[model samples]
Target: MAVTITEVVLRDGLQDEPVVVAVADRVAIAEALVAAGLREIEAGSFVNPRRVPQMAGAEELFRQLPNPRTVRYSALALNARGVEHAVAAGVKQVNLVTSASQGHSRANAGRGVEEALRDLEPVVAAHPSVTFTAGISTAFVCPFDGEIAPEALLAVARRFAELGITRIGLADTLGTAEPEQVVRSLGVVRHELPDVDFSLHLHNAHGRALDTVDAAVELGVTRFDSAAGGYGGCPFAPGAHGNIATEELVAHLHARGVPTGVDEDALADAVTTVRVALARGRSL
Candidate 1:
């Protein structure tokens, strides 16, 4: 089977940036990504401005997006309220994130892992038509807690499955995951959540991200998340730089004869936009 790529340049790219990208620019990037043959795009996040002012205009960004039929727009929601706002904004997918590490979960979500999962039930129930995917942060290891066991990640996935969430993503928040760990941890998760749709959210922290992506794809991971020009990371994730670039991932996949349906020239042009934005100390 072919791998499915989701463009996360707009959502994860702007998480820690200083400048706010105009609504028109966000829509422009989304339109460009759609034109590049990427059907799924994580457009923005529904979070508080006090924490992430860069994502302040998520609702407006959605409003300004070109309503394309072939593209599926998604947003990141931290809680039920955020999910409600995303659904109202006409997003088809809601990506909820939590960490297996108690310290990380508390620090990021203001609550423990269990509490975060419990809070997700209402959000999941409220949006029956919207697809809900739980992203487990620090799935391989944790910066604060350190050396997370495979069982820990499995336990969280089990809980998410119990909540009727079939789509799950394993995130390398700090970008320290090795290729061996990717295969081993994902092997166990695949066995446990056999029927669930799984994804890999890798960070290029150690520069082994491409190798890890290869291992994941070899292990039957079809869904993957990437950023344009390799933009974005957990502003809270210690020692993180950015996620794997969409162009880099596409190059690796396409060169290996994996069909991604992305035009190389168009993707290169998209990266130029990000390169220029970063040079200006901005994000898009």
Candidate 2:
């Protein structure tokens, strides 16, 4: 089967960036990504506007995006209010970010993992019409608490599963996880959550993201999160940056005899669009 790549350039890629792309330009970027053959796109994050000014127009961006019914556009909703904002803006799907590491949970969300998941139970039950996916951040490694064990991931995944979230993404938030760590952590969670479909969200900071991808593919993973220009960083996780570049990921999959159905040429143009919007200079 072919892999499904969720283009996250609009949200995770720009959340930590200094240049705040305008809402109109963000819409153009989304159109370009769709043209590149991406079926699912993470358009923006519905968070505090002042906290993540780059994603300030998250709702408005969705309102301006073309082909709402045709494209599976999603947004990162950190809380119940964030989910409401995205739903009001016409989003049918959302990824709820939760950290498996207690330290990160406290730092990012000002709560423990258990507390965060407990609060989301009502949120998920209230929006039965909207599709929800759990983004388990710092699944393998946490910048604050050091290496995270597989049990941490399993605990968070178990909660999401209880909330009817069948799709969970295991993230290498610090990008410090080795290929073995990737397989080891995912192995434990997959065993207990047999019915759950898991995806990988890797960062390229240590250049092991591709290696982790290879290991996960061997475990039968078919979905991954990536951005066009290898752009992205964790606002809370220090020194956490770079998602595996989407074009490179597509090419790597193609070389491995896997079909991603992404047009590299069109994707290149999309990357250029992001560059111009962010006013690309000596940096990404």
User: TM-score: which candidate is best?
Assistant: 2
Instruction: Report every candidate's CA lDDT.
Output: 0.83, 0.88
Clashing pairs in 2: none
Candidate 2's C-alpha runs over 4 A off are 280-284
Kindly list the per-residue Cα lDDT of model 1 for residues 119-157, writing each as its tens digit: 888778767888788789989878789977889999999
Any runs in candidate 1 off by more than 4 Å, and if so which?
Answer: 277-284
Reference-based TM-score, model 2:
0.97
Residue 204 alpha-carbon offset, candidate 2, angstroms: 0.7
Tell me how candidate 1 scores on lDDT: 0.83
Residues 1-284 of candidate 2 have per-residue lDDT tens digits of 68999999898898878878888888889989999999889999998877778888787888888788888888887777888888888888989998999899988887888888777789888989999998999998899899988887898899899888999998888788899988998889999999999999988888888888888888899999999999998888897978889998999998998999899999999999998988942232
